[model samples]
Target: MSISHRQTASGRPLRVAPAWVGAATPVAGSPADHHPLPVRDAVWIWSVRRFARLALWALPASAVLYGWFTLGVHVPPGPLPIALLAGWLAAVSLIALAGLLAGSRTRRIALTGLLITLAGATLLLPLAALPEESAAARVALAPGQVHTLVEAACAVSGAGVLLLGWAVFRSKLVNPADGVLLMLAAMTLGAGSYGVKPVPTVGALLLLAAGMGLAWTGGRLLPRA
Candidate 1:
């Protein structure tokens, strides 16, 4: 390294370090300086990942709960059942939200389908909640407008699920088998909507399997904290 000399205010000679030395050290705001990720950004990323994981896990759990309530328990439609159904709906919504993070080719389609499903489920909830002997129940269940509306809601939801399944099949994010299962579930559940016996049970079981597959996919795609 070469040194340089300069005259100071007192007229004494001052020695300066080589140019290479200055170049070797990082300047305060220069391009070569390293900057850490901000705390807020880190926290935001963590929260997002955590939510995605939870949503993936919720898919299977909500399916199982819905199946149990609809098939095994045969619980009467009331406040408790309605509350449980609401919770399941919320979980399903979360699952849909997580689909947005899939980074798949058909993610947009999947999200749209999920949103439609959520809307249909919302419409169905109140009808299902009506007490059996209530005047409102009789009016809704009568072969008329309300009954037709219920059927429409079911069909709409089923169509949405079918679309979601197709998107999943093309996504390549998870095993294609999961998409097939979802399609089957949609079909069975659609049949159940028309008073078909035992079909919805099968659909629910298939949904449970699909959920597990989704959860597995999420675990593989996301990094650990």
Candidate 2:
């Protein structure tokens, strides 16, 4: 006798889905194909990638060293300060160049001019300080003159910081928080240069913060495969 298939009390067929039914279904596409963040320009992003981390770290370290020096702490005098300043300036220059590449034409011009002014001022700093070392120095400038020169350097450098900060913010190349930190650092430093009491300490704190922001931003810009 022929037997019919077994059925449940609900009158449903007692059967399994065929294995071929699953095979016939289309596979879902990979999630990786749709990246949340789109890739930016390789040239501008990667150009600074290798050295950005180093610059980020060194900039903060140098700021700390200089801050201690400014505080008249256990820091040694002479070439140590000069060396730190040189290294700090070099790192800043690299960062500025990266910003310039990613910045608008107006910002590029402003940053470039400020950097040039800073370079010239830095070169003349030692010469400007000579009057303090030797009372009878042949190439001595008046105390007022020396002060003016130093203040000018500080002001110009601060302007460079401001421009770079604005550029980074405007370009949106890094995290928005990073741009805010950069701008704060620049403002603090600029304000401190005006002989404001206790402003230097605030500037030092902001400088450290900006360095951290830079490092974080650099990490975000690293290339992915």
Candidate 3:
């Protein structure tokens, strides 16, 4: 029987496999020879991806709900409205998280903006929960230092949103137009806070567009399976 031998670069003799066996064997360090993810790691990855996708889609739905309830229907500040608004804010937070997960180039900026926005939203929640007729609510809502603080919080939140929009604009994950829409949305929404007529509606529509754009980008992240 005849056998073949190969020499390594280091001058060592290397045994060559038979033609049939070599054809079936995968070459070391080849792409096909890579190890697969462990079950636990695989599951974790899948879960994270699923969460990102859901978060992206939720943004648009939450924006619509918030806008419709707060503006379209003029819902009074009560348990239902508060709950809806809270949900919307939560969804917005998730969208930020999804952006981070999507590996945006400006993830740090996005994260900072998210934290600032959450802080503002937190400060506003207690006031929103209070009954309008209550003395405490009246005091808080009165045109004074408390009202000024509220306005400042709103402005801070708007600034945070603007930062987030800028991050999105610079990120490679989504269309730049979406970021423009988001910035405009933040500005118009801030204007609405100051009693600008008909601007809130436009802001809500812009927000919807931005959210939809993010959702579209997220959908592309999912595996085709």
- How do all models score by TM-score? 0.67, 0.61, 0.69
Candidate 1 lDDT by residue in tens digits, 130-217: 5434525655455345666667878877877877888878876567888888788877776676866677778789888887886787
Instruction: For candidate 2, write residues 6-91 as lDDT tens digits.
Output: 44345543332211111122234644333222123333344544455555566567667656655656544764565457445635
Give the Cα lDDT of each candidate. Answer: 0.64, 0.54, 0.63
**Would you list the clashing residue pairs of candidate 1?**
none
Clashes of 3: 0
- How would the candidate models be sorted by TM-score, starting from the highest? 3, 1, 2
Instruction: Report the lDDT of model 3 for residue 121.
Output: 71
Scored by lDDT, the top model is 1
The runs of at least 3 residues in candidate 3 whose Cα sits more than 4 Å from the true structure, single-residue gaps closed, are: 1-39, 70-83, 86-102, 131-143, 222-225
Winner of 2 and 3 under TM-score: 3
Task: Work out how many backbone clashes candidate 2 has.
Answer: 0
Model 2 clash pairs are none
